[model samples]
Target: MNALFLTFLFPLIGFLLLSFSRGRLGENLSALIGVGSVGLSAATSAWIIYQFNVAPPEAGVFTQQLWVWMSVEGFAPSFTLHLDGLSLTMLGVVTGVGFLIHLFASWYMRGEEGYSRFFAYTNLFIFSMLLLVLGDNLLLLYFGWEGVGLCSYLLIGFYYSNPNNGNAALKAFIVTRVGDVFMAFGLFILYMQLGTLNIQELLTLAPQKFAAGDPWLTLATLALLGGAVGKSAQLPLQTWLADAMAGPTPVSALIHAATMVTAGVYLIARTNGLFLLTPDVLELVGIVGGVTLVLAGFAALVQTDIKRILAYSTMSQIGYMFLALGVGAWEAAIFHLMTHAFFKALLFLASGAVINACHHEQNIFKMGGLWKKLPLAYASFIVGGAALAALPLITAGFYSKDEILWEAFASGNSELLYAGLAGAFLTSIYTFRLIFIAFHGEQKTEAHGGHGVAYWLPLSTLIVLSTFVGALISPPLAGVLPQSVGHAGGEAQHSLEIASGAIAIAGILLAAMLFLGKRRLVTAIAASAPGRFLGAWWYAAWGFDWLYALLFVKPYLLICRLLGRDPLDHAIGLIPATVRSSHEAMTSTETGYLRWYAASLALGAVVVLGIIVLA
Candidate 1:
């Protein structure tokens, strides 16, 4: 447990060293500091895991309190790290997958401008994310939460010279902040009501203080969900994620796969106690997840950019996790989160390799028959794509996704079950569609990039993890979180799994039919008026950006214009204006003239004599 703090410390040190270098350091040293630091963090995580397994902590939880953060009338949250199965799972993902992504970045970012700066931001990101998962209290968690947000802004706009990239970074920051505000209100409500921000204490006190379906409890959880939605890029807040591809591909991998987008899922699972008290908000969480998965699936279907497709896929996969959480399939949600990290990281890193190989071209349409030119990337895509599509028993995604589908089914939520099925179908279609169109067709661009040890090591490792081997490494969450209700584990579960697996295969077959070979069918469909309209709509992520502009952005700007100069400021200025005017008038009367002084004195005396006579 003592080694737990070292997980974040290594990356913190790396960030400091790299930041001080100011991009003056050579790429080798910078990579060593950046990638090596995360590797060390990963190593620390392994040691902690070994220790936790060798001698399980009391209550299957360990808390390391370094010092009391502050004490105010018995309200104190400490600088502490809490380790349990849940946080341990997230710790492994953040450090392990993060280390691999960092390694791939070393190769992907070679010869790029500000190379050291990129690694510095990524190291800081790893530090922030680790803090987020490992914190013992909500206040500390929120500090880490905001830390990751700031790092995301910095990394997403790593190419600050490009206005579009900067705008994308700002968009991600602003959108997530909307959720952060809601989460902040939720935290305030929790502390005000429970008198503690410590997570375990809050969980213990919540049920005693508030009955099930309590309005105040519901409000707090709902606000927390709002924060999750924005951070995870669900529903209206999701527009920023697709545009986030304006950054480099590794940044895309880091955000989509292991860090920023998964924060929402982690938040909900972490606060399962509060959510369990508010069933309605929990159901809403499921609805948001269900609807988002379907919508993002459709959006992925029409995307042309290599990364945007994967971006929408990330959103859709997270939607599945949300759906699982909403259904009280807590472990299932977490399980999918873990498995998604494996495959999604593989896909993004491989996509980066492909882009670099093809001279940085990202259009799937522009990259065809590349399987021969780049066999390693091609294999990476196949393995990663199969896992993403959840192609039956061979891929890790099938096991995790099927668990979610079964949970939805077992919960007897027909609507959610259907949504999960549909999203799965859509996921398979678009995933294989990308693979077929990008890898199988005639070669459209000349592909040439050296396949060094840097490229193969990380990509190969991820490829292995994306397979069924990764599925075997389950999160030890049996006692940590509540056991899932409604898990019958009978023929019914098998039937649903088989059915869902069939649906996945069907979607892949459809993708092959449509995208493989000549792609005339997809082309014709695209050329049709209705197809064109639908494609555009889906491609714009169901017109969310437009709707937000109309509903929120436009009105805000219009109000700003109407105000012109704040009327309250003008009103407050009147007292100062009057004082200044009187001062000027009195100053004019004080002219240096003896006659004027004598006249004033005579007037005063006359007034005095008049008053005396009257008296």
Candidate 2:
């Protein structure tokens, strides 16, 4: 078997083992398998990267075919793996960071009753995500897409005993399903038009086969965008991600930060050739991403819960990535994806450590002055926060996010550029707002105390990576993508870097002034109408449960009542009544007495003879 298969296979093996063990395995053994599987996959991914560097695939791509998985009516979808710079980058991030999160979870979830089950779901999520990145064709990709959705639902509701968690998971599944339906239709249209689902072949044929403004291409692109939007928690479909903070912190790190959410960005980047064919659709992507960026950033600004703040922040950062992909900056988008996976995962895990130490307290107002006690977590949080805030000359987020902003400005999409800049400012403000409020305030609650090295070790490792990984991508990523795609300039200039750095610093200062230096200012603002609106998520999320109740539950009950009296029951009852009448009529035709049976038989014979004579 090829190494690509092993990347997916090992996690699946862990899932199966842990699943079968059913909470029976010793805690140590369960943790080992869970972490080990992803660790091995990470090692395998590194080897694959080494091989690719040594003997780079033609045009920076490689393919491995497993077998013909299915065929129908001259259409065949194979179980194949395609490796390229794109897939390789994603593989390393998913398995590498994924392994770290798993290890972190082992310590984080040490005393939880469902420790084994938690690992099982985590491994399964890894397996699905690997399949998503490694798949060669659309069918296989869809399989992986749904697989990850299932895993997400399972992991989000890992604490099944909690009704709120279950509801959150269901909401995620249902909302994403709406998008997945469109994605499925889009895939069907592609196969019907192109006659193949192989991504490489599709890319090769897409340019010549489809016209620049073809309606089918536009529709297909939009449909696929729907999927991306839902998965990435873009505007209108973003509510679930905020609610998903109900899951364990490691789950948040793995799913929201590193793996599951990035799939959407990956989808757009992987299909750059198809998207390039449709400029209108590309513009739509920019518009949606830009709007989502602004909306989510504002949402992040007011959230009190630490994870909800990160959740909204994740949405905003993903919006930037989408903006990059939208403006034809594929390489920059993927670069940001990598940087995001590192720092966001770090931030979430570090937050988890803090939340654990504080006895499950997540309210930023309740947390303060633990920087001295949980020094490692504090340090990791700072590294992650710097990356998030895009501080000058220090963090990965600065490099990747700044690159996207430059591309957006230089891409002839000025409106999008302006929106992106505003979002950037907000991003910086909200990120550090969380940092200063949570870490820099006076201690209000008693510290529940800190943990052993096992807890801090994974967070520290991520912190180091978060600080450094941004610079590694320029050479490899810039080399692959065409110059026309990224920005007007060939590479990032010092002046542009300084300007972005300045914007970031300004945002930080502004946040400090409003939330920290002048606390009364924020309080006064919150007393005002606009601040109230901001706190309420601009009313987008207000009465959400009630809206669901009125729209889904109350309406369903009304329909049930109406149907019960007027239509549904009566219509349904008619079928059984008609069957009963038919049975009674047939019973009359059949006589219980032997003499009646004989007479009927004789009558039938006489009738047949008469008909024959007449003919």
Give me the overall lDDT of model 2.
0.84
Q: What tens digits encode model 2's per-residue C-alpha lDDT throughout 512-545?
A: 8987743898899998998887677543544455
The Cα RMSD in angstroms, rounded to one decimal, for candidate 1 relative to the true structure is 3.3
Q: Write the per-residue lDDT of candidate 1 for residues 1-615, one digit (tens) a residue.
A: 788899999999999999898878999999999999999999999999888889999999999998999998898889999999999999999999999999999999999999999998998989999989999899999999999899889988989999999999999999999999999999999998999988999899999999999988999999999999999999867888998898889999997666779999999999999999999999999999999999999999999899999999999999999999999999999999999999999999999999999998999999999889888888998999999989889999999999999889888899999999999999999999998988887999999855778889988998999999999998989888888876778998888889989999999999989988888998999999999999989988889899999999999999998787788878999999999999999889998999999999999999999999999
User: What's model 1's lDDT at 306?
Assistant: 94
Which candidate number maximizes lDDT? 1
Q: What is the TM-score of each candidate against the true structure?
A: 0.93, 0.90
lDDT of 1: 0.92
Query: Which segments of model 1 are wrong by more than 4 Å?
Result: 565-615
Worst 10 residues of 2 by lDDT: 473-482
